[model samples]
Target: MVSSSSDPLATRHSTVSRENVREEDALKVLSAYLADDMRACNQAIIDRMQSSVPLIPQLGAHLVAAGGKRLRPLLTLASARLCGYQPSAEQQRHVGLAACVEFIHTATLLHDDVVDESTLRRGMASANALFGNKSSVLVGDFLFARSFQLMTADGSLKVMAILSEASATIAEGEVLQMSTQNDLSTPIERYLEVIHGKTAALFAAACRVGAVVAEQSEKEELALEAYGTNLGMAFQLVDDALDYAADQQVLGKTIGDDLREGKITLPVLAAYDAGTEEERVFWKRVIEDNEQTDADLPRALDIIARTDAIKTTLKRAERYAHKAAEALEVFPDSELKALLVKTVLYTVNRVN
Candidate 1:
């Protein structure tokens, strides 16, 4: 349930348990378990990212070296293992396919940085910031082409279809977000649709392809897809909330960037709905009118504090996290399963 406290900051001090494993620790454990496969995948990524064009390789290396957690590709590897995929010829296919997933993810990030006009990514200069928007966009297209090559090399039409659809869906989601940007009238349902397409579609495809490559049962594939989709939702929700709540240093990006971009995220919607008439004017002036001033972010935060927006947004995230865990219940207990469940908790606890 969302907190009822009128004190907007009350949730920050609420005594939620800190017993859940940290995100980094859980990732470390997963990485250790999949060390060999990850090594192969990393090598594959390096080999594939190379280009005769110096600028292409240089720009790709810059972003790839920026050191994201590789969580999406990790999900591909871990889900395959969770489905009892053993190391062998078929398992080598998983490594290559996992590399493909990473390529797709990296391509999206390149394009996203351009679209968001973001200066920083993964705590470093964004590709567009360093290489220029034209280079970033073209390199992103190259990555997409490389991803398709890997998919075709896998020789599974089903896998190709799933990933291709996800790619298209991600673009659609970006367009949807653009249409909704600065529009406070955007409903929560539409916002969710945008996230499912932009964020969760790739995640769902990543896990589902793992099952497909492993030749797991349909039920198991569906379960992994559910886990991935819900986990992605939770991940994006926490990210949205963190734009308002997180420390700029820890967040790796400027706080209030969403507001500056006139993006109406869930917390903003909640606060707008719950705000008084006078407060609504402030929101309209800043968000709808795009007239945010230097002092507006703090006052916007103050308005959010008076509402249950942050807590409610987090509550929704927790619900999705719980569903993600539940989706894995069909799989037998193991260290992998346990770690995946812990990952859900860690995702939600990022702002805690």
Candidate 2:
């Protein structure tokens, strides 16, 4: 049974606290507030992504130009200001580090496409699809190397340690996901572990490093880290839900790609848990044996709808979103804090 009061999916038409803020509005406010710093970060990204190897710059530029929300780097910059970072060399270091954060994220996307055999990204041909897997892998390595260069330029052992650890964690998470893929029995705790490494680790690092550069208190650093971590959890949950629910146009990826890829996400898990023996057999054939026919997607959607799976998954996402907002209570109220809080709402509302 779907609980309209608890399930955001069930209450889509209702105005709630999380539904009050628009992502575009929050981004506009954040961009305007961090205008100068963002400009510097963009320049630094361009400079660092350049390589003597023509293929490196060409492929890098292709993916970078494809465009994304730049959410990770934005977290780095925003966390800095939220922690009272002033405009100075310290601020410049924040820009450079923010660029490094972006490079790391871009590199991961390149590698992920190759791993997933994905043909599209951000509504265009993926790097692997456009440049071939070999070029994509090599260029991804180039970006990873470039990110380290920027990290070293900052000359802070603390920052280096944070980012390098995040890099390693991301790789580990990808490998863990590979292990879990095509296996329906994978537990929810394990799934959470996978996302923590693949996605939340960087989010935590991005915000933590910002506080580090600002020379903020340990409490402040941890507070921001908590904020980013919960926000990332909500973000990925929404993304996973979108795989089953969103239009391909709005999502910029094929609907039911997760189903085709034999990956089980939260919605699928929720449905599976609630399914009858007959439905379980269906899941085993399609997810475990990879015997999906074209009609499987619609059937899967039907099963998902029959249960409260979509609503349950989205309810979990809202919990994490609320946790993200709660973490900001540690910081004094300010425009940056309010915007950061609103951004959490914006992220979860992507489906709506």
Cα RMSD to native, each candidate? 5.0, 4.7
- Clash-forming residue pairs, model 1: none
lDDT of 2 by residue, 1-352 (tens): 1112322232243222735334535655677678888888888888887878888878878877997878899999999888888857544888988999999999999999998998778889898988999998888888899899988998899999989999999999888988989888999998888888889899999999999989998998899889988998888988888888887875577788899998868988999999999999999999999999999999999999899788888788888888999999998898789889878876777665
Minimum summed lDDT over a 10-residue window in model 2 is located at 1-10
lDDT of 1 by residue, 169-214 (tens): 9999999999999999999999999999889999999998989888
The whole-model lDDT of each prediction reads 0.86, 0.85
* Clashing pairs counted in every model: 0, 0
Cα TM-score per model? 0.93, 0.94
Model 2 score (lDDT): 0.85
Task: Output the number of the lDDT-best candidate.
Answer: 1
